[model samples]
Target: MEKISVFLDDYRKAPDGYVLAETMDECISLLYSFDIEHLSLDHDLLHKTRNGFMLVQLMIKEKLFAKRITIHSANSVGGKAMYNLLKQAQRDLILSDSTIVSLRPLPLHFFPANVMKHYLEVI
Candidate 1:
């Protein structure tokens, strides 16, 4: 079966065409076990915890990935910082359209139904 890995502390609504993985470990395992075509990350996983960063680094080191990654983070300061960190890693990123793109080439994409479809087709 096709799988999409998600690095998150909680399981909320999936933005269509994606699946959810409860923990970072589960996310990685899914990537190792299935054809993960996409990934979704939540920035403030535990507010003060750096699990989000750790998960991304692990994926980078393991070379486990989907074709694209999207961030569904809180629109808070910490969230932006976390998003920035991911961009520095040079991962292809998708962000909500409300956010302004500061980093180049990483692809700050928008969310919601239509934009998501466009992103899937483009990437």
Candidate 2:
């Protein structure tokens, strides 16, 4: 299987070498279609309700997993929820033990889009 990196967010363009999915559905499609090497996600998507947490829930239910998952939402509460869900899934043995789950929140507002890129890279 071909390995790919996925960046899931609504307002920010993906970093270099990543395929961008602006919505949860698109991101889910990518997860099912590809061997995801790195999957970075934001909690608040274009659709308020169909956010990254829902996608994470579906992933847990379907056993759809990436090698590495990062919660990159600026919304600390939402991002923490998603991150905790993944970790809980891992603890419950639903997600792979080897799958790396990380949280690298980015402020996705009140700044140029490039700021996200720098924020991701810098911290």
Candidate 3:
């Protein structure tokens, strides 16, 4: 089976070769349905029931994680919290040092448009 990449964001376009999930439920469903190789998450989904932070918590509790994960959230506080939680989960799970995981907060100017386009084109 070919593992896929997941991009979880409400208002951004997914990168090439990645599947997009606009809501926390959709993200969780995709995670359950696919063997995710890479996962990029975003916080603050306008008026959603759950956000990226919730997804990270679920992933940790269920012991479900991608081979590589990235947080591309613009919300600094939430993004940092998510990053911390994921790092803790990685430690608890004893993921290898080879695993590629990171928190990449985009600049304040990049949101819902330019940054998404740039990242989609580059990645």
Model number with the top TM-score: 2
Better by lDDT, candidate 2 or 1: 2
* Cα lDDT of model 3 by residue, 12-81, tens digit: 7777788999898898888888898888889888656488898888888776778788898989999999
What is candidate 3's local distance difference test score?
Answer: 0.79
Instruction: Tell how far residue 107 is off in model 3, in angstroms.
Output: 4.7
* Best candidate, lDDT: 2
lDDT of 2 by residue, 1-123 (tens): 888889999997788889999999999888889999889999998799999999999999999999888898998999999999999999999998889898988766554566545435422
Output the worst ten-in-a-row residue range by lDDT, candidate 3.
114-123
Which regions of candidate 1 are displaced past 4 Å?
1-11, 46-50, 91-122
What is the TM-score of each predicted model, taking all chains together?
A: 0.58, 0.88, 0.80
Q: What is residue 101's positional error in candidate 3, in angstroms?
A: 1.6
In candidate 2, stretches whose alpha carbon ends up further than 4 angstroms from where it belongs are: 109-123
Each model's lDDT comes to 0.54, 0.87, 0.79
Among residues 3 or more apart in sequence or in different chains, the pairs in candidate 3 whose N, CA or C atoms overlap within 3 Å are none
Winner on lDDT (2 vs 3): 2
